[model samples]
Target: MKIMNPSLDISWTHCGDGDDARYGKSVKRKVDRVESDGRKVLLDTNDSAFDFIPTAEPSPGTIEDK
Candidate 1:
C-alpha cells in the first residue's frame, strides 16, 4: 500500500518474485515502529497470523456524502 503522506517514514516496496506478488506476507511489529520494504501490511491482526493484501485504496475508508 502507498503511504497517505510522503513524509511518513514507513518503508515498503514491491515484491521480489512474480509468484509472491499474487499474495501477501505479514510482519509482527508495532504500528508506530519503522517498517521494512518487504513487510506486508496489517489487514487483520486478530487472525492466527497477520493478514494482508498486495495493494490498497488511496484514501482508505468509505467516502460518505457530505
Candidate 2:
C-alpha cells in the first residue's frame, strides 16, 4: 500500500552517537512515523538492528554533515 503521511516521530532521544551501538545495547533512535488507514506507527530501521543501518544511504540532511 502507498503511504499517505510519511514522517518520522522520535519518541525518545539521547545525546548523540558519542557512544557505541553495543554500549549496553542501548541507544536512542531518530524515530520515523508512518500512517496508514488512520493508524499511526513508529518506523526506524535502527531499532531492528545495527545491520539495517548499513543498508540505509545517508539522507540529504546527513550529507550536509560530510
Candidate 3:
C-alpha cells in the first residue's frame, strides 16, 4: 500500500516470506519526503523487515483526522 501527502510519501509491500509464530507476516516499508530545498530525501531505504498484523477496525472511540 502507498500513502501520499503534500510533503511526504510512504509505501510498503509484503515480503512473502511467511508469517512468524508470534508477530504475524513480514513487510517492508519505505518513507520519502521532500525537503525545503526542493530535494527529495529517502528517509528509509534499508531492507529491514517489520511485522504486520491485520486489523478489522480501530478501537472504540478512536479519533480520526480524515
Q: List candidate 3 stretches off by more than 4 Å.
A: 1-14, 19-29, 45-47, 50-66
lDDT of 2 by residue, 1-66 (tens): 343332333232333355454334323233354355644344454333321232233354332111
Per residue, candidate 1 scores C-alpha lDDT tens digits across 1-66 of 554553443334332346645354432232322247744333334332223222332233432111
Backbone clashes, candidate 1 = 0
What residue runs in model 2 are displaced by over 4 Å at the alpha carbon?
A: 1-12, 15-34, 47-66
Instruction: Find the candidate with the highest lDDT and give its number.
Output: 3
- Measured with C-alpha atoms, the lDDT of residue 23 in candidate 3 is 45
Off by over 4 Å in 1: 1-3, 13-16, 20-24, 30-66
- TM-score of candidate 1 to 2 decimals: 0.18
TM-score of each: 0.18, 0.19, 0.22
Best by TM-score: 3
Please state the error at residue 10 of candidate 3 in Å.
Answer: 21
| Per-residue alpha-carbon lDDT of candidate 3 for residues 1-66, written as tens digits (9 for 90 to 100) | 344552332333343434444243333222355568865544343322222222223335332222
Error of 3 at 29 (Å): 5.3
Q: List the residue pairs that clash in candidate 2.
A: 7-33, 8-32, 8-33
Residue 1, model 1: lDDT of 55
Task: Give the distance in Å from residue 66's predicted Cα in candidate 1 to where it truly belongs.
Answer: 45
